[model samples]
Target: MTDTATTAASAVADATNLVPSTKAVRLPGAGKLLLAQIRYQVRLLISSGRAIAVGAGLPVILLVASKGKDTRPDVAGYAVFGLTITAWSTYGVRLVAAREDGVLKRWRATPLPRWCYFLGRILATALVAVLAGAVTVAAALVFYGSHFGDGPDTQLTVTAALAIVAVLLVGAFAWAATATALTSAIPTVEAAFPTLIFIYFPVIIVSGVLFTNLSEPHWLSTLATYLPAQPLIDAVTHAVRHTSGAPFLPVRDVIVLACWAAGGLLGAIVLFRWEPHRSTQRRAARIQQ
Candidate 1:
């Protein structure tokens, strides 16, 4: 009986040895994950042909075709326009599409933190916007002889240059954050372009983005001055059109933009969703039950 028990024990041990042992797979740290996500998002944004064409190509073409003797304001306006296209329209559309396609849903299931994913996307959009805006500015300077200032008396100092760079950086992130928050309103990828265009074109026209609206009603012009685009354009215009040693920061415009950014960040935190619209609706229904 003892020999039989020993043989049974040996058989059990052999069976255990035949089975493969499981290894503990170590997950990457959050910092590494965030860096990887940011790099991936940057590559995705840079490869988007539509974003490039609309945000960079069209503006550069307009700059080339412009016949104005003073192209400084035009350069600034177009640079802002490029930024809006990249940071707002393109970014918003991509977010909505990702949610609709379940990409965001899948990402939410991963061990990766939600904020890291969003921050990566926002940073990538801002970087792309800056690149597109810079291309527009450079094209104007190289092709149109557009200077930062209106005349020789106006010059770009180191401080003023830094201010301009800061404005671009801030505006890019602001627009991107605003776009992310606004994506909650978009139900489908198909609706993104129409919705964004309806919001964008009218604002640009009223805000004097494409041209200086001199003949417009006084009230309309005043209203436009308060919109987001106008403030950005105004800030850029001030930076480019002012004399040497002039204040580059437009305090009122900066305040308005800051309000928008704060509102956008708040909205994104409150309303952002990871699931597709249909799934979200079903979840809501279940909760109501």
Candidate 2:
């Protein structure tokens, strides 16, 4: 009896030791999350032909329209700049609309890290923007005889890197802030672009896309420089022109973009709603009906 009892106790101890420890599962790292988000956004873009057409088509149309007989370098630069700006703006607006449509909201509710969600959208946008920018540059070079300086490969590389970074920052912030502010007011994905246009058109005009130069008052130019598109335009123009000087580091453009991004992030945090307005409205109408 004593031996049997001892055996049973040992068996129980062995069983307890055999049971797996309750180690907490670790969440993905920031890098992994970012990659996942990028993949997801890319997949979404591929799936939606309409989105791709709009995103890619507008740039192509502008390029075709701006392509002139002379093929001047300045013309090429401006054309690329305009196309890139449009791509960035379009992507930003679409991103917000998709998020407000509940895709991002659903992902946010999951166990996935928030950084992954945000980074994914950003990465996807960056990829599209870079590709679009490259195509725009190539088209300008081929059709307009546009050319960049043969400065050591290093300079070209650095300039390109800076340009992409600036675009991503500006684009992300514009999309986030515009989306949040409009969503707060309209609370529907359908209304996102129309609401954003009120802000977008003014920036486009002040950025001198239409004018030969920012011939506005000094204060207007200064203020416009701080707006999203102008800073990006200034950065692209300086880089393309290879204007080496104290004021042309592209840092000012980057700072303005950072401020926009920060402001948008804050607004999104404060006002983003997960529930669809249509659904809510439908339920209310049903209750009344």
Off by over 4 Å in 2: 1-23, 46-52, 69-89, 92-101, 146-181, 213-218, 243-248, 284-289
- The 0-to-1 C-alpha lDDT of every candidate, in the order given, reads 0.80, 0.58
Each prediction's RMSD over C-alphas, in Å, is 7.8, 8.9
Q: Tell me the TM-score of model 2.
A: 0.71
- Local error of candidate 1 at residue 46 (angstroms): 0.6
Could you tell me how far off, in angstroms, the CA of residue 117 lies in candidate 2 after the best superposition?
1.8
Query: TM-score per candidate, in order?
Result: 0.81, 0.71
Question: What lDDT tens digits, residue by residue, belong to model 2 across residues 10-47?
Answer: 99887867666789877667777777677887777657
lDDT against true structure, model 1: 0.80
lDDT of 1 by residue, 4-116 (tens): 99999899887867655688777788899888998999899877667777789978977767746555547778888998888888888899999999999999999998888
Candidate 2 clash figure, as a count: 3
